[model samples]
Target: MASFQKDFKIWVMDHLPGSALLSEPLSLEPIAGDAGFRSYFRLNTQIPLLAVYSPPQEENNLAFVRVSHHFSSGKIKVPKIFAVNFEKGFMLLQDFGTELLQPLLNLDTLPQYYDLAEELLLDLQLLHPGDSIFPNYGKPQLIAELQLFQKWFVDKLLMLDLSQRDLSILDDLFELLIGNAMEQPIVIVHRDYHSRNLIVHNNQIGVIDYQDAVVGPITYDLVSLLKDCYLSWPEEIVRQRALSYKSRAVSKGLMREIKDQKFMKWFDWMGLQRHIKVMGIFARLSIRDNKESYLSELPRVVNYVLSTTFNYSELKPFNQWFSERICVCLPRYPWYSGD
Candidate 1:
């Protein structure tokens, strides 16, 4: 055995069961392009294929285990946990191969993929606000997420040391956004339900990166999937599909009192908030963490925010602010072409 592998085996043996022998273990090859605290590796073994998750911290380990069990029991296609050593921050999981939804999305397959995603979203809505399996999406959490856009993307990424007046405008806009969110009916929200986090395995769509899931607006995950940063769909098609989702949600009694038009507004505004959050996250990943690959996707995220804001008269201030200040510094995303 190699030196690092030997050391890892010794550590695991001390902390985890059945680590006495690795059973034809292979070198730990790092999974590329993870955007979060957890690091993954493929542990090729003779007994069975396993993936390892080494979280940088242990704060969310309990939640991860609990929610994974909950979703798995609910028949959602998440990876089954084989072994977990929370103190060591290592988890051995069933290997779900990495043919993610992004490459699978073309004109012919887009509808089918989206339908599968919508089904998952419907399944998620079955989880209610007070479910013990997940965390609540309370006021403080909403405010903190909104502040990411203000702090990272608005100030840091844009390099805009805003004047007091500009700061006030930003604060007011954030309050309005959060206020709108808090007014919506809550459901289980898969906080990062985007293409890259979904795996196409054994002819089924399996969800990953769900440890951060919370109770939030019903439309939040829908918007995250359809208005994804890594992929772009046509506005007309997106609108049609979003409405289709709304109809399904209504049928499921997920939105008992909300009208279709009002639900559509909720969807749009939630998307705007999510996209703004993503822009900040992507920017922070690049600037602070020295992961510059996500910088390429910034334009698409910014465009989603811009297009959504432009659709509403009430968002005119946000629209003008972006046009006057942000647009000049960072031109329209190349994919948009002013269309």
Candidate 2:
């Protein structure tokens, strides 16, 4: 075993003395990790738990602990933290099991599960930002996320050539997306609220991978869930679900009453911002992080981008450039399909 894994096993032992993990050390099995650098191991004790090794340099372990407490206080279903050592970046947390919400979703079970998720989302948005270590999802951060597309996806992954005019057009598009996001009701955003990050635990949606929560757009997490990068759903159906959330939000006073068209524009444009940032993040995960599996999902995200690009008149120029340039280049990449 690698030195780091061995060290983590030792750390787990140090924290929990009488647990079966000490007697049966081999019961600790490596589980899959997310896009980040954290590593998780399942402890098959009398009560299952997860031993997590999250690097303090790369991850906000402090925020994770703080937000976990905050969300739990707000009656959200999150893993219970058994033990933590911030200096070493190790923790023993309640294992929510391997049942991800993504695989369980189907046409028959869709409405029920989605309704549960939406209601849970309202609970999340109701959390006060000042109650925790939440930060502003402001102009600098939004722009930086947008530039991820330019640096990783366009340049490193695709290596696209563009004229000054094309760059100008992209700037305007970015401005509009960021502007729309800034106009929304500010609340605690889970930053990565999507299907794969959610688990079905004991008949409730158990949310995870929320270390990056921030005070930002109300529609941000909603868009991330309904229009997930990992799953494909009909656009019209996704929009209708978003409207359902909109009604709940207004009723809860999470948002003011707005016209359907106006709300949709916010929803769709918010998705564009997220999808654009995700393209860069996925490209970085492939090239820099050696996780090529993220490349395979590009087609679905590309489909999302194309759908939004075509819907808005202001996005016509970028849409044409994407079709003529970006689309033409995508077919060459083995992971990309025509979608």
Candidate 3:
């Protein structure tokens, strides 16, 4: 504890001159984060502070810093960066207390929160196609992420030992899915925009864990919020809300050319792709990283993939395969039972 205090105190002092004096640095606690990264805490401050210590060697520290700055400038509510040391891979950020959208989202507050999310989506789509600041989420990357599902979840995690023929079929299905996603209107995508990544502070939603922001389909983040893996809503209700959001976006001239049906297809296809990627990520976190908490969310992720794939005639083959093979082999988790 003392050693961690010394290192954290020194780190804060070096980056933020007066931060150490805020309070005596306390022991580090592990904070729950997405599958891609790990984070630790440094509390014991009068301001009830926490510092995210993501190692530079393990993750893209520079991208996090840059994206945070870009989004902050764009009026997105991300935690303000107080200080940063790129070479050392450390940053001091304003602590947005633990008021996550997941725990705070109830029936009464759902509509209001969804409205705020819609506004954010409008702002996100305002980003142009050729934005140099964000990474591209084209066909190749989408296919690659889907393949991770095939490799990790189906093959390694489930120990399915799929034959070459089965593997080839899955690969072809993934290619089709990626092609569908690439055909949609592209925008800046907050790759993991969901209830868990949203912090509700002072009656406002602040986004976090957006270091992996990319230039992707406009519907990507929308579906991530509506078909959230951690929480489930009725399909009809989600669709109605999605259409409402689309109407607002069109009125705001963010998506001027696309019709309602075309936009719906974009939402469904992007969701299918994201759910596939998330399943693989969750499986990897459990089997490889020894994190079991995400395992409970697996069934919901699978449901999103199954539901979206069943929407189109072209995806019938993929849909049938999931029902016969995947769904039968893996029963739904308890959390997915109620809704």
Candidate 4:
């Protein structure tokens, strides 16, 4: 409270001069953050505003500014930036209130909300990505992310000392996943377009935490949505919804005419790559950052990885290794029963 009060007051005086907040008492309430270094505070004033304190060393404030502007120009419903202090890593943004789409989701509301999210994603894919300054999600980046599983989850978390043969198997799996990703159509991917990052403002979907957007596979964001790490939908339903998206993509001419089997191969492999990366990320969040709550979601993500891998003959060897060595060593939590 002491440190925040000093910085918040200075930010108000410096950025919000002559505003209504300066003339009255202001109250700031801490808002729950995600698995990141950023902190959010809601300012209880007439003007709906949010104060973000994201340390520049850990978070990219400039990327947020640039991407927010880029998305806004494309008519995407991202939070409006009011003020930014790059050096101090503070940003005052238009508050979207407390209504996140995660808690509101269920069997009844999932269809409606997911439809809206899908529509928004299509709109994103249609944009001329050449105008933006996002990174390419290429083979090297994809493999690096997968290796986080070895660095954080397998070694640090599970204490697994992988043998040379085990490492070779993983290398082959990574290549297959990377090849699948590079073969797809590229678009602006909102790398983390899950339930938690989406806001339901005025009955419309509002996007947040999009600084990591990239030019990647068309199926990347869809996998993040339908097969989200935070929540799981029935496989049949997920496939139906994914096929609906395929139809939409075909209509938009974003995807070429491919059979359902091949398209699903792309989707499943893309999701495998993501779930593998999330495993390492969640473990790192728990061990390094002391955010152990993410540990609970590890089983679900692992199940997603195993479920897909077991279905493919090429992935059978890696699946056998994970089932025999890794899966058995996983801590027995409530989600451990998933795989």
Candidate 5:
């Protein structure tokens, strides 16, 4: 009897021309939602479809539809939008089934799955829009994301008191991260291209949660997939896969042949930025949105940032601060793991 749900159902019903298939009294079972305010429900129609309620004020209903059309035409596997009402923030899309790409990932299955993922990613990057609607991932956006880490994770979550020197150090690191992102070969980036956001249906990897896609550094999406926030992989295996994608990108003329170390630096730095942003985002989700489960995943993100910082000399200052300030205090939390 909720207003939005009732209005959404009415809109979805109008879009489906075959009203004769109304034997089933419209039942809308809840589907798992993401970090956004969007809600999804599985419709019991003869052909399974999803009814989504993405709030117009909070979510970009128009952008999702536009990106979906753009990506579908670009040969990427994405949900086919059946009908949409932007004003009401309602959409009926092809149901990609219950199988998520997350649970199916493992060492034995990773090579094959990652290959598929990388292939789709390459297809996505091949799209170079001349006057596209997708925004550029410029310094302003990157800086805003980095500030979330400092504001939420460092200040609110950890209750850390940063002196003038500490604040200056963070400001310097943010600038470096922003520069790292801006200097790469620009391409379409699915900002959250990870296992959880991907769908496995009919033995194919279908992309989802790509509404936030933007034109950014080529290494952005690759790092998002390889150094996933939810899971960890051996360094050697992750490196091998990362390099393999670089090779493929070169072969496809997405980028010219580059040194493995150079590509690795971009990939690593990009991940560091993303994980740093996530620290702030995860904290915001916990404190502002009341999603406490997000805090459990911070340990994996910490491991990723530390792994690269310890290897690279430029990040030494950050490594020292994280080790002395952040890492030392993490052990007190139940989810903290040094390993």
Candidate 6:
């Protein structure tokens, strides 16, 4: 047996001795991975399970386990961790299946699935973080994320040399975005709540890749869900869905009665903060990790930036910078066409 495979088997036997998996032969097949460093495989044994091999150096397996436990305790629909070997960075989990919510999404199915998603989100929001440790997504962290767009996307990927004026405008824009985010109601944030990280199983929505959950602006996850990085919905539909969620949230006392305009502003600005960070992250993933497919999603994210920024007079300067400096150069790259 290969040393790595042998090590995985040994760890499983030691950690999961009484499980039914040991009663039969084990077979594993590779499954598609996420943006993170962890790799997954299906354990085709008498009892179906998933074998996750997270590189100890790159992934925080312990935090994943702890968060899984916390979510499970709160009745959140997250995959169950059957066993884990933190030292080896190996874990056995309940197989949620191959049905990511992204592929099933369309105009027809959008409302149904999104309604369920919002319900799940509200459950997470209402749950008290009594003993669970979640990182604070505060001003410093928010500002740092905004910087990713300038550092990785602009400087590294686009190779743009910004003049002093451009740099000053970007800094001002970052602070504006940070202020918008910090002004919202804070709650549990599932940092990546988009369709791809959601699993549609047995007529229920199961969430994954939640290790980066945080206490942040309540609108953060809502924006991540409705104005997704991987898909787009009509502006009217997005606004309606967001309003519906706000009504429910207010009824449940999860959110105070804020003006619809204020809520939408929060959602839009929060999306810009997220999309800006994503541009930097996607570029870094392609350049540093050789995950080139992430580059293809850049144009959609850029469009989100422009569409949101164009509406606000305060963001006109940044919008002009994008139109003058970035959008014109986009056609040169195969991944972006300024659509």
Tell me, by lDDT, which candidate is best. 2
In candidate 1 the C-alpha lDDT for residue 176 amounts to 75
TM-score of 4: 0.95
Candidate 6 C-alpha lDDT tens digits along 203-248: 9899999988889998999999998989999999999999989999
* Residue pairs with backbone overlap in model 4: none
**Model 6 weakest lDDT span, ten residues long:** 15-24
Candidate 3 lDDT, 157-262, residue by residue in tens: 7767777777776877777777778787667888889998888877778898888889877788999999998998888888998898888877777666667787
Q: In candidate 2, which residue pairs get closer than 3 Å at backbone N, Cα or C atoms, i.e. clash?
A: none
lDDT of each: 0.77, 0.90, 0.77, 0.88, 0.88, 0.88
Error of 2 at 30 (Å): 0.3
TM for every model, in the order presented, reads 0.89, 0.96, 0.90, 0.95, 0.96, 0.96
lDDT of 1: 0.77
State the local distance difference test value for candidate 4: 0.88
Q: What's model 6's TM-score? A: 0.96
lDDT tens per residue, model 5, 176-201 = 78888887888998999999988887
User: Candidate 3 at residue 215, lDDT?
Assistant: 88
In model 4, the worst 10-residue window by lDDT is: 15-24
Q: Looking at model 1, which ten-residue stretch has the lowest summed lDDT?
A: 12-21
Question: Model 5: what TM-score?
Answer: 0.96
Name the regions of candidate 5 deviating beyond 4 angstroms.
17-22, 337-339
lDDT (Cα, tens digit) per residue for candidate 2, span 1-339 = 489777877787776635544445445788999999999988867777899989888999999999999999899999989899899899999999999999999878889889989999999999877653898999999999999998999999999777898789889999999999999989889999999999999899999999999999998999999999999788778989989889999999988999989999999999999999999999999999999999999999999999999999988878998888788888877899634
Q: 4 or 5: which has the higher lDDT?
A: 4
Among all windows of 10 consecutive residues in model 2, the one with the lowest summed lDDT is 17-26
